[model samples]
Target chain A: MSLLAVGTLAYDDVYTPYGEVKMIEAGSCTYIAMAATYFVQPVQVVSVIGGDYNDDFLADLQRRGSDLEGVEVIPEGKSFYWAGRYHDDMMGRDTLDTQLNVLADFDPKVPESYRKAPYVMLGNLTPAVQSRVLDQLTERPKLVALDTMNFWMDHALEDLMAVLKRIDVLIINDEEARQLSGELSLLKAAAKIVEMGPKILIIKKGEHGALLFEGENLFSAPALLLPKVVDPTGAGDTFAGGLIGYLAATDDLSFANLKRAVIYGSAMASFVVEDFGTRRMQTLDQEQIDRRVQRFGELMTVSL
Target chain B: MSLLAVGTLAYDDVYTPYGEVKMIEAGSCTYIAMAATYFVQPVQVVSVIGGDYNDDFLADLQRRGSDLEGVEVIPEGKSFYWAGRYHDDMMGRDTLDTQLNVLADFDPKVPESYRKAPYVMLGNLTPAVQSRVLDQLTERPKLVALDTMNFWMDHALEDLMAVLKRIDVLIINDEEARQLSGELSLLKAAAKIVEMGPKILIIKKGEHGALLFEGENLFSAPALLLPKVVDPTGAGDTFAGGLIGYLAATDDLSFANLKRAVIYGSAMASFVVEDFGTRRMQTLDQEQIDRRVQRFGELMTVSL
Candidate 1:
């Protein structure tokens, strides 16, 4: 089965202690599509960008097995651009620039071929935009996983919850989980969110790892224990890519499968933080992916 | 085949949002011995107390299969006393009182029966006291695990490093590890500590979990993902008890065995946080232990 991801495909400027790199290729849809391409045969990406968005960048995504037919090009506007500097901890960041450009008034249109895709990933974006993509889907996808940030939770909470009820899984960072549920305890927050809609809740704790809670069963996947994290800009998106990619490839959404998916996501996220922006993910290959997955298995295993 | 734990046994007054309990039984040695007794047949405890130390308390430790022959009673002084208040997170606490009483000028004397024990747990205490206990051992234990706090690291860096060189395993919290090694990254800190002396290094991350680093192999054991934590006073000591206890019970110090030991320690720590002080460990039985172990296995497993 194929997977379709809906979000921004944009250019980013990232600053880290390692150094500063300008005009780095980034965005939720870009990383998610790249990561998912490893597990699935073909991944479809739907988003809008301006003429300034380079052809080479689009070609790279195509090279990674992503179908770019759904990616719309706006000749007048510029691609979404964001600039941020990560602190030493890599856990916190300060946004230096955000020019929505084409994303300001863009609309997402799921291509006809992608309409039949079995899985859908809603990356972090405006609630209105996310809802628009969902509205365009002819049939409900077998599984819908959504990733959102604090912005949507604060500004578009009602729309966010509306989308939450329609999705099968809701993935968010720990702080957002606490804010959405109005509960300080993550467990309590997850339980409350599950009651609101989604059957599964994945709480991402950044460097600490992620948790998969379905019913009474809870599984934790630790982030790759790196000595130093160069940049953490898109680690969360990379994790989401791994999560939905594994599920789409296996066509299995069982709790056990979801646990493995989280591990894959964590392994992919580890690479994302190894270098600034998408530098590491760009150079990552199947061999490196397998080795990191094995490392995650060994790191997490409990021998009897 | 057996383990000996040396430290204080005292009454603790603790307050938490869940509730408050005055004069609850608590002490690093007491919790450590109790946790160790779960896996090992009998844990020998060595320490001193005053006339005020209750017989019923001593009986409680003995009932858990701890040998109290090494406990010395001081005729005139009072027992050690501690009071603390847990914040909302439960991961940090404020020391409200610390009356050393008989512990002020204590000199631990390892009993003849305990001198030949194969495993020894040096719970948090003065570096000099830890060194004295090491000096008293007739034959070097197969494994010596030392647990220390930031207090000693700040006050007695030389003595602490001296004792660290003589131990087989060193366990300290994440902050202390950073301070001792002057490295912000845990991976770097662990590597630095291994160079200093111990072959095995454990960096505790409180609720997040703990990391065990030996040479190139690293194993992470997550803390029990509980919805609520009543108290966290003795959780670290209980964790140490479980680690050394599991090691002594298995009589294996290989990396594979260390993985299981960390899981056991994590499970024991989970129990400690469920209630105030050592209350939960006190009521825990073999069946509960088995079930928690099974849960941990399931939580970390991935069929890759």
Candidate 2:
């Protein structure tokens, strides 16, 4: 089974207490495709970038089985650029720069070959753009998951709520969940958000863990408790990518399978935070991924 | 086998969004003994109270198999009085009043029959008082679990460390774990904390959940997702009580048993938050408690 991802692909400069990096390759689809490759193959990506990007990065994605035919590159324009600094705890960050040169006019074009992929992941982007991708799909994928930020909730509620009604799953951080639902209690927030649209709501609680709420059932996914988190820029997108990819591979949407999917997603995210800007995710082999996932299961088991 | 709990006994005036209760029977030992009685028999308690306390409250404790021979009553003084207001989130509270009354000169006295009890749960109290109870023990108990607060970390670090060395387990909230270890990452904090004394650490994250760490093994317990949390005052102490009480009843301290203990603790803690000042706990029956605990098990399980 194949997975389809649609979002921005760009160059990012990130600062953290541990250190700083300049002009590194990053973006929503970038980390998503990288992490998803560990689970399902032929990750077809639909995103827009500019001529300023490096060729080696494209080669890396393609080499990892990413179908980049839908990745548009405009030679005359600069790529989307973002600069941010992570706080000491790695839970919060301040956006220092965002030059949306090509992304400002980003018009995603889902390739004809990619439109019928079995799984779809809508990475953090404009809700209208997310909606546009759904409009382009020739048939509904087996699973449709959407990830959004506080930006859409603040500026584009109409578009966001409209898109939310069409997706099967919504992946967001704890703070975003609170802001979007206006509920202080997460349990109440999950109930409210599910009422608004998606059948499943996954609230990502950074290092604490993740919670999956579907109907009356819930599953708590454990995050690998690391001694340190170097950079957490793409952890959430990586998690979403890992999740949808696992679902596509297993071809099951049962709550039991989705629980395992969350564990897989958590393992992928744990790798992302260990290094800077997709570096650790890029080098992860299947054995290393399986080992981390096994640990999650061990961390949760109790023989009674 | 018996469970011995040593802590404060007082009257609490609580203000929550749900409502307010004036001079309700409450205390660290009150909730602990109530929760412990659900799992084990002969819950021996050591604490001080005032003559002004209600006789019906004492009758209720004895009705639940609480051996109160060690409880000291001061005829001329008022009971320890506390007033607090829960914040909107229900995760934090502000102390509006604290009249130590008889607790000012509180002296814990462990009874002879309680000295050899197989399980000990020291609810939040002064480090010196916690240590004194340990010193009074005739022989080392099978398991000694100590729960404390940030107040002791700030004022009684030396004594806390001394008691920590003698205990088998330490239970504290996530914030206190960070403060005690001076490590922001919980994984690193657990590594440091285990080195200081106790071999096991349980970091309670109010509504988020709880994490158990013992050497390389770990377990995550999910907090019950309530539609509304009326009060959170004695949830932690109740958790400690449930945990030790289960251990005592089962007479097992293996890793597998400890994992079950935490789940029982989480189940007990969840009940405490549903109402004000031990109201819910006082009314709980065994069947209701077991059903909640079974639900927790189902929530955490992920079939591979």
Candidate 3:
């Protein structure tokens, strides 16, 4: 089954205690495409890039089995740019600048071939944009997973809620889950979220791990606890890609399958944070991915 | 194999958004004894109470197979008392009052029966007191686990180090691990701690779960992830009780056994915070514990 991901393709400048990397290729859609390409072939990416986007970066994605036919290039505008610096612990960071040059008027148009993709991932973006993608779909995909942030919930909750009702699963951080559900406890927040829409609710706890709740089935996937965390930027999006990618490749969305997918996502995310932007992810291969997933299985499993 | 626990037995006045539980039965040793009693019978508790300690509370301990003959009742002093209020989220709290009273000069005397117990748990307390218990041991216990707080590390570094050298395992929270190791990364902190003395180090990330590191094995256990957390007080001590108690009951100190014990501890601690101090744990039975452990096994297990 093919997968279609809609988000941004932008430039990011990231700073960590280890040092800084300038003009790093980044964005939610780009991250998803890169991570998913490891498990699934020809991930169709629908995003807008600007004239300034590095051709080499685009070529890299093509080499990794990411189809760029759906990515629109706005020749007159500048690429979206974001700059952030991680704190000492590297779990949290402060955004330095957000230049939404090309992204300011982003109107993602899914190509004809991409619309019928069996799996869809709507990365964090304006609710209107996410809804636009849903509107373009001829039929609901086998699975529609979404990633959203607190910003949209705070400012565009009604639109976000409308988009949420159309998705099969919603992936959000702990704080976003709490804010959306008006619940303090994550478990309560997940239950409330599942009632609102999606059959599955994933609460991402960053360094703590992620929780997947569907009805009464609850599964936890611990973040690969690394001794050094260089950057946390795009880790969440990478996780989403790995999750959906694994599920798409296996053509299984059962609770058990989703649990393993979360582990795979976690493994992919662990590589994303090892270096700035997507440098580490760019070099990761299937062997390394499987090894990390095995490590995650080992770190969390115990026989009675 | 009996388990000997040394710590405080006191009353706590806790207020939370859920409600207030006044004069709730608390204390590290008390919580530990109750949790440990689930897996190991006849847990030996050594600590000082006072004339004010309730008779019914003591009777309840005896009924639960807690050998309290080592409890010294001071006629002139009062039982230790602590008052605290949890914030809305229940993850952090502030101490309102701490009246050492009888615990001001507590000199725990290890009973002759407990002196040779195979398993010994030194609950969080003054490092000097912890050392005294270690000194009283007639023969080295098969396993010695120590729990200490930031207070002792801040005020009694030498004494804390003295005790660290004698313990087989050290149980501490994430913050304490970072503070003690001076490393922001938990993995690095655990590594640094293991070098200090303890062959095993368990970093408790309350509500998030616990991590166990011994030799090359690393095991992570998820917290119960309850829908509601009425109170978080005594959760850590309860977790320690569960961990050591399970190990003592099985008399297995292998790395695999320790991993299972950590899960049991995580399960037991989940009950500790379901309501105010010892309330949930008090009502928990072996069947409930078994069910929770089984769920934990399900939540964490992944076939490779």
Give the best candidate by lDDT: 3
Ranking by DockQ: 3, 2, 1
Question: Taking the tens digit of each residue's C-alpha lDDT, what string does model 2 give over A1-304?
Answer: 9999998788999999999999999999998999888778899999998888899999999999899999898999999999999888776799999999999988899999998887999999999999999999999887899999998999999999999999999999988999999987888999999998999999999887899999999887777788888999989999998888899888899999999999999999999989999899878899998898889888888764
Calculate model 1's interface RMSD in Å: 1.5
lDDT of 1: 0.88
Per-residue lDDT value at A210 in model 3:
93
TM-scores for all candidates?
Answer: 0.96, 0.98, 0.98
lDDT of 1 by residue, B198-221 (tens): 999998888778899999999888
Q: Lowest-lDDT window of 10 residues in candidate 3 chain A?
A: A84-93
Point out where model 2 deviates above 4 Å: none
Task: List chain B TM-scores, each candidate.
Answer: 0.98, 0.98, 0.98
Of candidates 3 and 2, the better by lDDT: 3
Q: Which digits, one per residue and each the tens of the lDDT, describe model 1 over residues A200-282?
A: 99999886888899999898887777888887888889999988999999999888899989988888898888887777888
- Model 3, A182-240: lDDT tens per residue? 98888788888988789998889999999999898988888777988888889999999
Compute the lDDT of residue A193 as modeled in candidate 1: 94
lDDT winner between 1 and 2, please give it: 2
Q: How close is candidate 3 to the true structure, as a TM-score?
A: 0.98
The Cα error of candidate 2 at residue A147, in Å, is 0.4
Compared with the true structure, what per-residue lDDT tens digits does model 3 show for residues B1-304? 9999999999999999999988877999999999999999889999999898889988999899899988999987899999999888776899999999999999988888788899999999999999999899999999999999998889999999989999999999999999999999998998899988999999999878889999889988887778788888888999999999999999989988999999999999888888888878778988999999998988876665
